[model samples]
Target: MKLRFPTATIAAVTFFASLAAGMTSPVLAEETASPTIVTNLRATPMVPANAPVRFAPPAEVVQTLSVVPAELTAADDSVTDSTTDFSTLDAAVAAQSAAIDDEELNCLAVSIYFESKGEPLAGQLAVADVILNRTTSGRFPSSVCSVVKQPGQFSFVKGGRLPDIDTSRRAWKTAVAVARVATKDLWQSPAKNALYFHARHVSPNWGKARVASVGNHIFYR
Candidate 1:
């Protein structure tokens, strides 16, 4: 057998139960009724309303930058003395010119001996300079030996062989020394770019621009 409560009593009991739950758990009401708190996480700075506004293009600025001042000194005083010798410049330049070296040196020495054994050191260097210029011109073989032996170039070459150079001869020694000086470029050549030269006696009248005359040879470019 089942027993049932009266409808009026049930209604009253349900109403009282809800009231008791509210009293027991007031935190649920507070949580439901409270306003949601919004937080600002970004450190975004606020510009003051009275401050001057500045606009830097997006492409120009990635970060703040600062510059520091550099230390400076007074300009050096100009030279007032006039006693400096200017010709000494030329002398100094002449003193600085020296020789270049190896198989190249041997070839250069041979050319100097045959072409200018009697000529002074300057003349021998001038000869070597001409040969050097020829090599660089693209018209002749780039190597010193090939340039010397190029067809019909030098008169002393017979069947591609230079007459044996005698080391004992003073002229040969001078020629070797000059060749070394010329090869190393230890001394600057006054011949400059003269690619052709002939004995002083023979005026090839090649009508070429004559640049320098060293010893018995006249040089032309």
Candidate 2:
């Protein structure tokens, strides 16, 4: 004989079977859930090898710049010292005729006579000419004292022996004015390159070696 089970009992059995199959299935477990990963993103600074970097403190930059000007100034002073020569009033008169005056001419003559009397006329004029040559040479000082005081230049100045001039004297004033005129090149044909000069009576080695002769003096180029 055949027996029939209750409908409610059959339905409950079917539901339990389905639940057990789902729990044991690998495909169902993978499809149901997954773990999520989170990542953090932040900004970073990059430095270049050759790029100019700024200093943290601005005062340091200013200090570096300040030292540069002093260095440049020192270099310029060195150049000036090397190139410039100090000339005398006599040299100025020889170089620039316009700067010379009667007073300066007389003073130069007197100075020459005091120093060297053998060639009074030529020596005086020649000394004056030398002073003029130094004026425009650019190697010498632009002013009178500067040129006269040039180191190791003139014998008279070797031991720091400078002529004492009474500035208040009429002769001194005249000499100064003449020196100015001679330095300015006011008069021409006074002397040329007369670096070395001597009297007409005495034939020094320089006398024969001169490029030109003017008045009682022989001059060299």
Candidate 3:
């Protein structure tokens, strides 16, 4: 069978076909448009002017150190230092003779008693003078007890103590009298500036200035 269509119907059909093709062609062309490539590195995002920014607190900083007290440091320095003013032992002790008293006087008396009881009164006075000098001298201990008790320094000291002295003995009383007079400066020792002494029996060869000879002992500075 032959199919026939009117001209106006054919024209209408042609117009509808053209409209459909035009709409679909644009969509297909857009799908095949040039593509843009994205990179691994991205630019930093810009924050809006009014945006609230969040920030973590900076890491806490810590410091540790030990400090010493100034007073404690000073005390430590004083203990380790032994040096003092350089003054003549004779002049120093002579100026303060009364400092030797109380139990300290007894110590001086005992030292003189045991050391020079056999010698004359002058010898005992000289011994006491030597002890006082040593006390003032910075080279020896400052206290009378300390000077008398110093090891290997005095022949009378024994067992780190003075021997049992007989205070009742006349000799001891004489020694006490001598020590009192010497310390009180009532009588200046013949060995005025002497800080050392020894029995005449043996020479220490101290090679020092000889001050005086009293009884059996010779005194020197």
RMSD of each: 16.9, 14.5, 18.3
User: Is candidate 1 or 3 superior in lDDT?
Assistant: 3
In model 1, which runs have C-alpha deviations exceeding 4 angstroms?
1-101
Candidate 2: 10-residue stretch with minimal lDDT: 35-44
Error of 1 at 81 (Å): 34
Q: Model 3, residue 111: displacement in angstroms? A: 1.3
For all predicted structures, in order, the TM-scores are 0.53, 0.36, 0.53
Per-residue CA lDDT of model 2 for 107-139, tens digit only, reads: 453444334444333334455667667655776
Better of 2 and 3 by lDDT: 3
lDDT of 1 by residue, 1-221 (tens): 88898999999999999999989788887786665532232345667999998887664354323333343243332221122222432332243323333677778788988998876667778998899888888878998899898779998888888778677776776666676555545567879989899998896789899999989999998
Task: Return the TM-score for candidate 1, rounded to 2 decimals.
Answer: 0.53
Ranking by lDDT: 3, 1, 2
Question: Model 3, which residues run further than 4 Å from truth?
Answer: 1-101
- Candidate 2 vs 3: which has more TM-score: 3
Q: Give the Cα lDDT of each candidate.
A: 0.73, 0.52, 0.75
Pitting candidate 1 against candidate 2, the one with the higher TM-score is 1
